[model samples]
Target: MTSPSTATLHPIGRSTPGTEWWRTAVIYQIYPRSFADSNGDGLGDLPGITAHLDDLAALGVDALWLSPFYPSPQKDAGYDVADYCDVDPLFGTLADFDVLQAEAHARGIRVIVDLVPNHSSDRHAWFQRALAAEPGSAERARYLFRDGKGDGGQLPPNNWESVFGGPAWTRTTNADGTLGQWYLHLFDTSQPDFDWANPEVQEEFRRILRFWLDRGVDGFRVDVAHGLVKTDGLPDHLPAVDGDSMGGDSDDVPYWGQDGVHEIYRDWNRVLAEYAGDRALCAEAWLPTVDRTALWVRPDEMHQAFNFPYLQTEWDAAHLREVISESLRAFPAVGAPATWVLSNHDVVRHTSRLALTAENPQGHGIGPDSPGQPIPEVGLARARAATAVMLSLPGSAYLFQGEELGLPEVIDLPGDARQDPTWFRTDGERYGRDGCRVPIPWQADAPAYGFSPSGATWLPQPAEWATLARDVQEADEDSTLWLYRTLLATRRAYALGSGDLEWLEGFGTDVLALRNGPVTVIANTGDAPVALPAALESATLLIASTPFAGTAVPADTTVWLLAG
Candidate 1:
């Protein structure tokens, strides 16, 4: 295939007919509460997102992904959704969502909403009814409510632990003040896992899918897409492995990446196909392998799954080259385009995470107080280079909010302001993800950095954000924000997305070089500059993560060359 014409690189497939926009689109993730606030409530709402639509349009993204804005007790942010069909009052009414959708479509941008099917808030009406009903009653069947073990059922049902921390099961008191059965919550006690084994549970999600699709939502970002279904029986778990905090490479876990989850997506895919407009589903599954993750997008299931193995891999060229090559190889077998990402709300910002040395790689938790953290400048430099590398690859890409502005995780959040359940459950031992979820900066001088007119932010913003604020960065040509805008425009001009990647060799052990259509992207991760190889010596330079001298590629930099 030739490089995409400079015209809008349509996600609605240049190679095939119909709306497969998701196949190669660059989707921006908006963490609603932190994106912008229009009501002076110090929290972002649907209308706030609507107000900022033009800014996103100017950023040149093809789609906007809103993290859950559903009504909830705020137990696990919006992930513990209490209502799936309506907008949370904290955000706005369904009518407000309609305006946001209409405005976005008017700008030629698609909309995808977050769908948390793996679990529901403990306060959900269904969960409430389950609590009031008897153990074997149909009301309790929607969730994984099981009898406790040991005398008088005092102990939990099994040895499973919460991904946030502590025991996964939460024992409840009966309506009559008696010790009742325990329910499993993979994350927090207030977020109970649904029993996908129940046909009613599966049917309810189908109805939910139809409700949103009917509202013109382009698709759903399936939360914990690998976790809807558990093993046949609620079984005991083996001791957690070194990297098994949330997800890992193990295949036999009782609740993760089960074969049953694919069936659930296959069913959902049928629902998606019924709607026109190239409706699609993107799974947020953290399966152990790229091949295993590819199963969710096997033409009959989700159209795309987050390429987290790429996200989790260390910042080294050989490792990166292997991941890129294997990912490109694995997805085509399933006829799906690989999705690339750098960071999200749930983890430390890649800027900070990449700063860590190999000896102190991060796990589930990170904060300013963490021992031996790397300097901020070093992390940001690597992050900028990594972003360039990601955009040059084949398939779709998802950008976490504020990444374009080079936002680093807010590590200095005070202990009093910590809200992530991981922090509370672990009893202050772990700082949790609140740092990454801090409100983003939009204006260098405006109140709350222009995130809110009231100058109040839900999560505290660090004082250093003044320089990285969007307005400040947008004015500086050498800024990270400018680099992202230029990168996106260059990618579209070169038609790099959704193309075949041919690995090019002889650039040295620390340099990664690949040909995506007419574009050749070279990334140097070595400690010193390297002379450009003969193959790329005469290629036209399109863009680079950092300025270069003559034919030498600077250390920790990525450059895009237009090949003849």
Candidate 2:
């Protein structure tokens, strides 16, 4: 029996051979400002990425997912989009983006750009018009605006906090000298939430999707995918017992994962289907559970969603095993591929995160005074092991730029130099994400570490990153970069991206032995080494995260074994 998805050429998706290309593809995330700086403007532009496409192609990723490069005031580090149809001069022109896409396609790699339809920068043309127009006019109707509560309208309409911090609603002033309505901003004040109930808003987004699709983009990595619509009459969000106001629970939170989001993607899917290729949409929906997350990726909606369950699981073997089991069951039930991501522009680098015993409180960004003392050496070991096991699994994997070089979070960044809006919004209580977004180190001693010819970078680089520079790692086979290249090559060659998962019995609870097709992946997370059974010892050793050539798997290590 052929399902409708397989019956067709592709499911509004990514078709390379017969399978949807994104199902098993390795996608690399490039944070434009932190990637490379081509011009001498102390910032990274599209041409900087264009110049480094070869490096990504050599790394064996099937595609590259770019962070937002759209024109903006950059209030939220480009997440606050001022214009969807053009590129920001700080990044590059649309012409430069076209060149990069053409070059990437030429190298057989797909390009997926960040699509931020959840909200627009306050400086956006529509929002500016909405401000000038009367409250009941069509222009004002495009934004989420409501009169304040209380007799004098001095109080906010609702008691919702911003994702960054503080009140979610900001009051607006009219042509008169009096304060008027309050507008919702789930994130920063500069990013005003859109009125999704408006048909004009929906049509505008559909047009934006076609604008990028017509430009020959392979797909879109939707930002805040679950936040397309708020519940009718935007209610106050009451926190759970554990104090999770957002994330894989908190369904009662009126601003996220509403039923209305499904309809938006379904319509987007139809628009994608109208294209020639397997143009795809990957959702970043953070729902209450893996089961809930699966809803966003159903055949008629998005093709993939980030597997936060796997990334959120601690370093403990028992906990990880359980999460992996649940994810394998949940995603398959929906006929959608699960995406594995260890780090991204928003989170702390796993090189530091993997070493910490304590998890940061939800919505609390870790900064200079955060808990958990990070042991970099231990972190590097665990990061390598964790990535090896993640890549060997049967799904899409996203590699954050600089993960290949084993980059640790720049925890000691100077407070005076910090730029993340969370830092200011929280009055420096939260360190925010500026640390993990520093520029890539290309040379051990080149000016600005070869990030640009000007020897200038938007964010300062660590002086000690000389050893982790790509040039230094390129020559060392034991380098994390080399290991990544090897891992990617093996995964592609064995077609492990679309493999099946089956756990091998008899191994201790701390010893994870899972078979993905003919490839056996074993990870020993206990403090003691675990000996492989006779069957696996004789099996060929495809690769190991650590140095090993024995029948026993070392502690905190992962190995991929090829069966005869």
Candidate 2 lDDT over 339-398, as tens digits, reads 888888887788888887666644455566778868888888889999999998988999
Cα lDDT of model 1 by residue, 1-564, tens digit: 112122322234233542367878999999999999988888888888888887888788999899999999988889999989998999999999987887788788889999999999998999999999998999999999999889999999889988888899999898779899999999999999999989999999999999998888889998988887788767888644435565745677888888888888889989987776788799888867898888888988889999988988877999998888889989878888999998988778988888876333223557666776867988888899999999998789999999999998887888898889989998987788887888888899999999999998888899998999999987899899889999999888777885778888776999988888888888888879989877668888888888876499988888888865
TM-score of 1: 0.95
How well does each candidate superpose onto the true structure, as a TM-score? 0.95, 0.95
Assess each prediction's global lDDT (C-alpha) against the native.
0.85, 0.86
**Candidate 1: what lDDT?**
0.85
Which residue pairs collide in model 1, if any?
Answer: 11-21
Which ten-residue region of model 1 has the weakest summed lDDT?
A: 1-10
